[model samples]
Target: MPENPVDPPGLDLARLRAHLDRELPGTVQGPLDAELIEGGRSNLTYVLTDGTGRWVLRRPPLGHVLATAHDMGREHRVMTALGGTGVPVPGTLLLDPGTETLGAPWYLMDFVPGTAHRDAAPLAGLGAPRVHAIGERLVDTLAALHRIDPAAVGLADFGRPDGYLERQLRRWSTQLAASRSRELPGVDRLHGLLAARLPESPVPALVHGDYRLDNVLVDEHDAVAAVLDWEMSTLGDPLTDVGLLVMYTELAGVGGGIIPSAATAPGFPSAGELVARYAGLTGREAADLDWYVAFASFKLAVVAEGIHYRFRQGSTLGAGFERAGEIAPVLAEHGLTTLKER
Candidate 1:
C-alpha cells in the first residue's frame, strides 16, 4: 500500500488514528495507513490497516453537500439493523456521527473478502455457467432483501412507505434542481412522464436504493458474499429495486447500454429472467416494472447530473468523472423511450 504521511484529501490519517484509538481502544495498533478506495461516486470510502488489523471506513464526499445524499449514519444504521437478517453486510465496529472525529461522520466495518464485479472482463474467464449462476444469485439475493420485514428488522422508520413513488419523483426532481449545471434535454419531460404514470407500489419492503451486480460482492463459489453501498437504502417500494437491477442486466446488449457490466457476461440472466426470478422468489407483483424502470432512469439521470455538477465545481475525487455528465442525457432519452413502449 502506498503511504502518504500527510492527510489525504478525504481522510486525515493522524486524526483518524486518534479517533480509532479513542473509540475502538485496541483495535488498531502501530501507525495507521489509509488508502482511498476509488470507484465510489457518492460517499468517500477508505481502507484502514494498522499492521495486523484492517477495516473499511465510509464518509461523505469532500464538498458540495446534498441533503440526504451522502448520509453516513443512515447508511450505518441500516447496515447495523440488517445484520440480524440474511443480508450480508459488513459488521459495524464504530460509527462517529459527529464531525469532531476527522471533521466528518464516518463508520468502520469489517472488510470481508469478496470481489465486487464492476465490469464484464473480470468474470470473462469464469465461463458461462458460473456467470449465469452469478446473475441468478443476484436476483435471488434481491428477492431475499425484499422479503425482509422492515419493522421486524428495526428499520421501519427508515423512510416513509406511503406515497413512495410520488415522493421519489419529487425527490429526484429536487436533486436535479440542486445540481442543475445546465439544462438537460428531456429531463423535465421524463420527470413529468414518470410523475404522470406513478404505479401503485406493492407492500413496502426494505429497498436497497442502488441494486446492481457491482454493488454486491461475489465470493469464489460464485455466491453473493455481501450486499454493499447502503448509502441509499431505505423503506420503499420493492419493485424499484427490481427495476434498477433490470436496468443493469445486459443480455446480448439488449439491456442498459450505459456501462459494460458483469451482467453482460456470457449466459448471464436476461432482464426478463431476472424479473421473473425475483417475482417467483418473493411472490411480489412485477406488473408496474416499466414505470419503475423509467423512474430508475430518471433517478440515474439526476445522480449523474449531480456528479457532473460536483465535477464542474472541482469537488469530485476520482477520474472518469469528466464523462459523468454525458450519461444523464442518454439515461433521460432511454427513460422516455421506455415509458413510450408501455
Candidate 2:
C-alpha cells in the first residue's frame, strides 16, 4: 500500500472497508488502499489491501453495461462452484448482491499471486521449450474444463446448453446492435455466414466464455495458478472456448495491441497444435472448427465493439480502450475470411 493511495475509479475504499467490517468482520487490518487492475475491459477489477492482507474485488464496468453482461453474482457463483474441480479458480470470499455498498454488486476473492501474461515479451524470455510447455498447459487446462460435467459441478442450470451455437450468434448479434456506433464492413456478412454454418456442438460442458492465456494466471514454474475472469463462464458449447482460443492465438500478430497475445511468443504452440491438443485430451472432434473459429471472431468483434462503445461513452475506466474500436472491423474481416476458406 502506498503512503496515501488515491481511490481508483469505480471503487470507493472507505465504503468497501466499512462494508467488509460489517459483513466479514476482522478482515481489514489497516487503511484500505486500492488500485484498479488493468487488462480487464469488461468488468472493473480492483486489487485491495489493508496493508496486511490482499484481495481482489470485481464489479460491473462503470456504464453502458449490456444486458446479461458483467454479472458480479454470476462470476462469484461460478468460481465458487468450480472451487474443488480440476479447473483452478480463486477462492471466493463474499458477495454483495445489492448496490448500496459500491453502487454496484461486487464480490471479493483471495488474490492469487502470479502473472497474467498479456504480451509476448516475458514469454519470449522463457525460451521456446518453456513457452511451448506453457501453451500446451493452457490447452490442457481448457480441455480439463470442458471435461467437467456441469451437473456434477452445480452449474447445470448455469446456462441453456441446447442450441448453444445458434443462441451465441443471436446473443452476440444483440450485443453488437446495442453498441453499434459506426458501420463495420464485414460484420453482417460474417454473422450471416456463422449463422448459416452452425456446427453440431459437442456434449454441453462448463464453458469458460473467455479462456485464453491472459485470462489465466501462470506461476513461475510455468503452470496455471488460477483461471481468472469468470464473467462469461456458462454451460454451453465447449468448442466455443476452443474456437476463441484459436482466434486469439492466430490474431496475436495482427492484434495491434488490442488483443492479449502471449501466444505470439516464439515458443508458444501454434493455433493448430492447440486445437489438436484439445481434441486429443477431450476426445472431441475438431472437424467443424472452422465454423467455431469464425464464430469466435464474430463474438470478439462484438465484444470489441461493445468496449469501444463504452469507451466512446466515457464509461471505460482504464487505458487501451481507445484502440478497441479498431479491432472489431479487423476481426469481422478475419471471420469472413475464415468462413470463406472453410
Candidate 3:
C-alpha cells in the first residue's frame, strides 16, 4: 500500500459498512480496516480488511472523471466480463455505480496477493518460464477477448468502430497540449508522422489501453494472478494492444523493465519472437505495427509526464514522478527511432 492514499472526497463510510455487512456478513467482525492504496492516481484503490485481516475492495477516485476515460463502471464491467474466460482476474464481488453510496462509483473484488514489479528484481524472481508463459497468456487472452462479441456481453456501446486511431491521436494531442510542462520538439513531429501514416486497423476489439508487466500481479509460482488497471480499456484496434506490449518490451531493456520469455529471464522477447507469438495466436501479421508501437510510446510518455504535472500541482505524491518524466524523452526517442527503422 502506498503511503498517504488519496481518498476521494465524499466517501460514504457508513454505506460502505452497510454494503459490506450485507455482502460479506460475518466475515467483517469489526470496523473495516480501510486504507487508501497509492500509485493509482487515476482510480482510488483501498486495501480493506476484516477484524482478522483479509484484504479486499478496489474503487475509482472520488469526483467526476472523463466519461470515456475513467469510468469505474467500465473497469468493473471488463473484470466481470472476463470471469471464467481463462484470463485471471480478481473475482468481482460488487459494483456500486451510484454516487449515493460511496460519493463515487466503486467495486469490490477478491484481493489477489502477489508480487508486482517495475524495477527488475521482482521480474527476475518470476523467472524465465513464467515470464514466457505470461507472454503467451497475454496473446491468448487478447485473442480470447477479441473473439468475444461485445453486443453479446452488453458492451456494444463501449466504443465507436470508425476513426479510433484518428480519435486517439487527437485525444492525446489535446492532452499533451493541455498538460505539457515544457515543449519537446519531437512530440509534434512524431504526432504528425503518426497522423500521416495511419494504417487501416482491423475491426475494433476490447483493447486494454495500458497493458504492461507492472500492471499485472504474478503469484509465487510465476503465473499472472490478475491483470490490473483497465482504466484505459475500450473496444479498439487489437494491434494497439500488441503495440503497447511490444513498446514496453523495448523500453524495459533500457531501464528496470520485464521481458516476456520463459526461456530467459528479464530480457525482452526478440522482435521476431514477439510478433510470431502474437501472430500464432491471432493469425494476424504484425507488419507495419511500428506506427502503433511508436504511438504507444508517445502516449505513455504523455501519461508519465502527466504524473509529473500532477505531482507538481500537488495532486499526487512520491518522487516516482521525477523518474516518470524521464520516460517521456526515452519514449519519444524510441518512437522516433522505430519510425525511422520502419
Tens digit of per-residue lDDT, candidate 1, span 1-342: 445455668887888888887888988867788778877878888887877778999999878978988889998999899896777888999998889767778889988789888767778789998988998998888888988888898887999999988988888899899999797999999998888878888888999999988788899998888898998888899999888877666222332433546777777888999988888898886987888888888898898899899999998987667788888898888888888886
| Candidate of highest TM-score | 2
The reply for model 3, stretches above 4 Å from the true place, is: 1-15, 22-27, 38-41, 53-55, 60-67, 98-103, 253-264
- Candidate order by lDDT, decreasing, is 2, 1, 3
Question: lDDT by residue for model 3 over 1-342, one digit each (tens)?
Answer: 334333334355567878778876875676655766654546667777654656656555333333455577888888888777667778887887777777667788888887555555555566666666666655666666667777777778888868999999998888876667886758788888999999998877777888766677767665677888888888888888888888876666453222222223454355557768878877777768999899998898777666656656665543344456666777788898999998
- The per-model lDDT (C-alpha) reads 0.83, 0.89, 0.71
**Residue pairs in candidate 2 whose N, alpha carbon or C atoms collide under 3 angstroms:** none
Q: What would the TM-scores of all predictions be?
A: 0.96, 0.98, 0.84
lDDT of 3: 0.71
Give candidate 3's error at residue 69 in angstroms: 2.6
Arranged by TM-score, best first: 2, 1, 3
Model 3 TM: 0.84
RMSD (Å) per prediction: 2.0, 1.0, 3.9
Go through the candidates in order and give the clash count of each. 0, 0, 5
